[model samples]
Target: MHRFLLKLSSCSLRNSKFQRLILPSLNLFASGSPPPPSANPYSADSFRKSRAFSSKSRALGVRCISSEAGREAIEYDVVIIGAGPAGLSAAIRLKQLCQEKNTDLSVCVVEKGAEVGGHIVSGNVFEPLALDELLPHWRQEQAPIEVAASSDKFWFLTKDRAIPLPSPFDNKGNYVISLSQLVRWLGGKAEELGIEIYPGFSASEVLYDASDKVVGIATKEMGISKDGSKKETFQPGVDIKGRVTLFAEGCRGSLSEKIIKKYKLREEVNAQHQTYALGIKEVWEIDESKHNPGEVVHTLGWPLDPKTYGGSFLYHMNDRQVALGLVVALNYKNPFLNPYEEFQKLKHHPAIKSILEGGTVLQYGARTLNEGGFQV
Candidate 1:
């Protein structure tokens, strides 16, 4: 009877919804999603009741106004630091939240770069899930994705040859993009939503009120480029206060670290993980005979013989250009393993050489990647 009952339970578990719920939990543990929150039914109830009460109070004609004037330092409803993906996403959410509450919540975004894309660097293959959900009709509006990747090639290489390895998700691959273009587009969308984005302004310090809550930010004066040269004039610090300050500075975020330490936000940065890699890249005008219009080739091994954690990519973008690059982790024991040499050696490979044979390198640059993969 017990065996029969077990079989019946197994059969019931085969239902689609049951599998959907169970599969994600199993995968979450397998993929390192955080454990469920501790039970706090009373606190949860109180939180919901408080929000409802706030909504009721808001409807009772409670107006939220800054205590100071426009010329004077005024506090915003929301202030976000760093204009990266994380910061922009937070701003969008805050806008939505304010809209739902029928409140005129002022938002200010502080960016340090000359423009939004100056500090951004990536060999980015983006899955447009977030973009599609956030900005519907993105494609119809001519989104900045360089190439919609339909194929992904993972090649394991020897000194002279390469062998393709079957990928786990060969059926679905991500789209490739020039990260700078995408960032500029995202900044435009944020601005369209009435989110005041101040580029070329560096956030130097955070301001806290008497209760030790983050109330505002102190921005450092920035040098703006004039007709042909940089101007060395100092602009006075502008203080923009807010109810909440969200720091979305990307990897090795200085301000984020400072705030975390000052507030003791979590016991010693719970996201204590590190993975660093130096990416050396060059854009080349592809030789017509060798160019496969929309191909993206990725390879591992070869140039990095002893190192098991390095890879190379050659992506064909629009405008007859190809982005060729190699990323190698700095954890290798060899103190003198040159990434530039590795990149040059990769170009000499028979498979890689034939493709880039007559191509002329247009630009050369390098940047660091935070490969800690969502630890924050």
Candidate 2:
């Protein structure tokens, strides 16, 4: 009876044009009770009938079927490998392509982090080109950006004093944002368009076809039970086959590195062609009297030798919290040059101290930034 049920399920799944294609040898199992009618596109009766038809077709040795229009429906159009900015952007682009072509192009996004904001830490300043183009009314909606920077300052600092300089670039159109908030918003937009986002699942391996074409991924399940024990299980990762796969795992992308090495991509590119910086940042609450709501300050030099490339920034974000941080290039020879120490010394600078007087640090963290820009 179990074998017969399995065969019926396979047949029904295969005959339903709305259902995605599955490999003939693949086994299907439900993790929990069947989903509700509203959750699935097909009704239970329709699914059962399709299953019966699929079983009959398979018995007759027919592996493929033609629609009334004599065209074969595709299972998926694209499968993005990561859920970071690049992967999300690619998914959005594929949706646009499907809309333009008036076809069903399924796009799936696979993220290893438990949440969209996991692994993302930064004093992120975005150009707003993509966001503005994609969502024109973002500003009017009062998005949770830290501040729309109106000024940029460069300070060469000593322990107690500093020299401030004007930024070489204009700050007219740029903005500083909470990276977590931005990612959450972007994820929401992707989901609204029917993009499948699988978070908290890490891709264990890449799937390739017999001809060596990249197909999908195998993701490991991750979660903890109510008693705090880890759950052990695995699921078929995002396998939207036939479409382009984008690798956007942020900095130090391990999987992306493997793929680059395997494909021997860009052999001419120097391994040290790029530079990395470790940035330590914190949010502090300042006395309302000392708070400057829209103020932004940047400091460079001193504590850091002139040869070393690094800087510090302090932005008075909304809600009386000040974002203070320092970034130090990793290429420096002195391993003793601690980023946290530099940040502390920077706070003591007379100019900075006056601004942050009596402020209390609330949150502290560190992250890596790609200083080599997009080309690297």
In terms of lDDT, model 1 sits at 0.62
Question: What global local distance difference test value does model 2 have?
Answer: 0.58
RMSD of each: 16.9, 13.0
- Candidates in order, TM-scores: namely 0.72, 0.72
Q: Which window of 10 residues has the lowest lDDT sum in candidate 1?
A: 1-10
Candidate 2, residue 154: how far the Cα is off, in Å: 1.9
The Cα error of candidate 2 at residue 13, in Å, is 38
Looking at model 1, residue 17 earns an lDDT score of 25
Can you write out model 2's per-residue Cα lDDT over 104-179, one digit (the tens) per residue?
A: 5556576776566555566555577776665677777545554676667777787667776777756566665666
Kindly list the per-residue Cα lDDT of model 1 for residues 1-376, writing each as its tens digit.
Answer: 0000000000012123222122222212121333344422112121122221244323433223322322124355678888777777678767766778887666767778656655666555666677766677788866676476667678988889998997543314456667656666666666656666666567787778878888877665344465545465423455656777888777667877788778765555575556777888877787776665456677888899664488888776666777788988877778888888888899999988887878787766777666554444
List, in order, the clash count of every candidate structure.
0, 4
